[model samples]
Target: MDFQNSLAFAKELDANDPLARYRDEFLYPQVNGKDVIYFTGNSLGLQPKRTKKYVDDVMKDWHELAVEGHFYAEKPWWDYHERLATDLAKVVGAKEKEISVMNTLTVNLHLLMVSFYRPEGKRIKILCEEKAFPSDQYMLQSQARFHGLDPNEVLVEVKKRKGEHFWRTEDILDKINEVGEELALVLMGGVNYYNGQVLDMKTITKAGKEVGAFVGWDLAHGVGNIALELHDWDVDFAAWCSYKYMNSGPGNASGIYVHEHYLGKKDIPRFEGWWGTKKETRFLMQPEFDPIETADAWQLSNPPILSIAPYLASLELFDEVGMEALIDKQKRIVAYLEFILGEIDKQVESTFEIITPKDRGCQLSVFLHGEGRSLFDYLMKNGVITDWREPNVIRLAPAPFYCSYTDMYNFGQILKEGILNK
Candidate 1:
């Protein structure tokens, strides 16, 4: 498809877009009395307009039913989280029984490690990418310290080659082989947060398993952004936050996926909780812990319905337009954004070096050569909401559900002016 930098071309594309109408479903913040071109959806998604009703229903249930809301409310606060399982499973490409909502991202990762990170004498090292998300880095370091090992000795990093922006699949596989018998776990972010590179999880997971290591993914950015089949990929366990592309809210609840192989097993080595036990026997006050026959066994407490409400609201949009359709629009829209960036770069004296590789999802992290924080400030003041990393990189994520092609074109215009004025 030939790309153009004009507004008419952008409008033509938007006119034909099947997902265009869904943009009205979200509420955006205004700058100078106009809606800002939101590019931070990868960090925190815009709240769905329907979210208020979901939250209100839960609040109303609590007000009317009080203690009876647990089992007698309209949606039943006891099983409210179960409403998210089926649709959430469809978004991440897992069986309904293999997915559960709980806690937060880092918290769930810590709990999952209890079951998957059993390091024997010879197999104690963990493999992760260099400069992972700060939360993940801290989590891995603390986990190793908890097990009485030097983090520097127990955590092996797969570093990118000098001057390169992304990791090669071969390098990661080679690192897994180098760590060999010492590799107890292979856990890394599925989509790199810094450069927006989507790592080849299937190949890496296969390599980790071949070396007798338990493989898992921190799908914080990968969950709703890219195609994932944790069950088919034979992933042992995985977890993600709902605030990003999933569009729940700020620091909302998280989702987890555990393989069916570990379900219904008494010796799976997980922390026990009343909510994780079988529902029928939960109120019976039994002495023994009978784990649920699904991924819910990993849950440690009853889900917070207020947090899950917005998530379930977002999943309704996912159900209306499936991931397949979302991915289709994502590819075309991101391609158009790239074209706009190239066109703008040609017009301006400054260089825009896009570090994000072709394997990216919605985000395009660009190194703004000859630009500074003032340019980012100018963009924000002019109603372009983007994320600025340290140095001069800006991440522009035009999420498919709400972002439009005209936003990309208009951003190109605003960006060119910002560079020229500087």
Candidate 2:
């Protein structure tokens, strides 16, 4: 689709957009009595208007039904998380049984690692991309230390070439082969958080399996933003937070996917809790853990109904439009955004560069050359919400669910003004 860097063209696109009505579903922050152009959904998603009603339903159950609400509520608290499985599975492209909405992302990562990251004998090293999200880096370092191995020796981070901003797929595949027998686990983000580069998870997974290593993905930025086929990709496991692109509230319960082959394996080591036990016999208080034969087995505790409620509300939206429609809009809007920025670059004497890859999600990380946070502050003051990474990058994520093409045009105008006025 040819894109024009004009408000008329943007409004025309918005008028034709199939997903345009979704913008009203969310509540946007206001600045000077107008809605801010929110492009920071990559960091924290805007709250859906329905989220309050959903959480209120849970609160009503608690107020009237009290303890009996566990079984008697309209949507029973006891199995609240179960209601999300089918819809969540569609968003991430996994079987309903393989997906479970439970703990937060990193917590689920550690739980999955307990079962999948089985480092022994000569295969002790765990491979990940360099500059992974800080939490993941810390988790990998500590997990290696927990296994009585030096993180420096056992944690292998694949680095980009000196001039490259993102990791090349071949480099990752070659590293998997280079490590070969010594690599126990291959864990990386489905999308690089910094540059918004969506990795080729299928190829990476195949490479890891070919080399006898367990492979998993941290889909924190990929789940609702990009089209994923985790089960078909043969990814051993995967985890993602709902708050970012999924537009669930902040720090909401995360979803997980465990391949069916591992579901019934009782011999697999896991930090089991009572919630992991089969629901039928949960009341019997059995001493031995009878794990549910699905991703449900990984759940450590009964989920917080309030937290799950917001996610359920968000998932309903996902189920309505589906990933295919959302992805189409994603491609179009991102292309328009790129086109607008390119036009801005031509008009302004600014030196910023877009570091994000073309094969990416909603986010485009702009490297502000010979400038600093002051320009970012300028965008913020003018109600263009974006995120700033360390050094010189400002990330903008125009989410398809709520962000319109006009928002992209407005962002370009504001960014151009911000650059020119400087």
Candidate 3:
């Protein structure tokens, strides 16, 4: 595709986007005086205008009701966590009872591991992608050491074939089949932080269960940007943060999922706290911890109501625009980005390569042929904002809710200047 040819095409696409009006909802960053092309929604989403009001409501409740807010406010603070479940369940395509709004991503992962990683004799192994976020790797290592197992022996890291930035679906499935008997848990990120590849969660979940292995997903980058069916897919457990595509502020509350099939079995050993106890019998001063028959059993402490308010605001917008419509819009934006990138690749004859899958979701990872870090800094010196990974990869994500096709074109133009100017 020709560069000018593709740029013209993109201008038209932006003009006709039905979701274009949605851009008015976010707080775009300003550099000097212009709206810089902010495409790093994978790392941190732009804040929604509704978030301020959502947070103010909580502040008002606390100011007026104090402790009584737990019982007396319009939406009782005691029941605040419950208010988020239905919307959380719908976003992940799971039953309401299976989903619960709770702690941060790494915290929930460790909690889930405590229950699911009961290593018996030869069954004590954790399988994960090598390129997983460092926090996840640390959690796995620490969990294995807590059980007195060598991290090297109990943890298996799946690597991609040579010269590949992303893992192959077939390789991942075949590895599970090959080691099905000894694997205890499959923990991985939904969309890799580096390459922006969207893994096939349903297929992997099925393959893991075939071998009796517990499967879990960390959806920090996947939650709001992609469509999932955790219930129908029979995902054993999953956790995600709302700060990325969910448009919640930094360090906002996260969510968890537990298959309904596991509920009602209160005897199932899990690390629990008073917050997870049955609400009806919770304040009876009972010594025993009786968990509610849902994902709520995983909570170890009372939720931060102030933090959760932002998610409620974002989820309502998500409900307004269903996942199908969102995903369709995302595909179009990503395709437009890929088209522009392809045009750049043609002029330079593959001097820059896109590492993420071409047909994938809302993000792309670009690699410079000459000097990656220098080019990265040059782009940053300009009005473009993208994330750079170690050893030469820069990630750009144009979220559907607010990013414009004009932004994608601007990002490409900035990239060209960075390359040619260098």
- Highest lDDT model number: 1
lDDT against the true structure, per candidate, is: 0.95, 0.92, 0.85
Q: Across residues 2-100, which tens digit of lDDT does each residue of candidate 1 receive?
A: 998999999999999999999999999999999999999899999999999999999999999998999998899887888999998888879999999
Best by TM-score: 1
Q: Give the per-residue lDDT digits (tens) of candidate 3, residues 311-346.
A: 889888888888888899898778778887777767
Q: Model 2: which ten-residue window has the lowest total lDDT? A: 344-353
Worst 10 residues of 1 by lDDT: 73-82
User: Each model's TM-score?
Assistant: 0.99, 0.99, 0.96
Q: For each predicted model, how many residue pairs clash, with residues at least 3 apart or on different chains?
A: 0, 0, 0
TM-score between candidate 3 and the true structure: 0.96
lDDT of 2 at 170: 96
lDDT of model 2, residue 23? 95
- The alpha-carbon RMSD values of the candidates against the true structure, listed in the order shown, are 0.6, 0.8, 1.8
Clashes of 2: 0
**Residue 311 miss distance in model 2 (angstroms):** 0.2
Models ranked on TM-score: 1, 2, 3
The residue ranges of model 3 lying beyond 4 angstroms of the native Cα positions read 1-8, 348-350
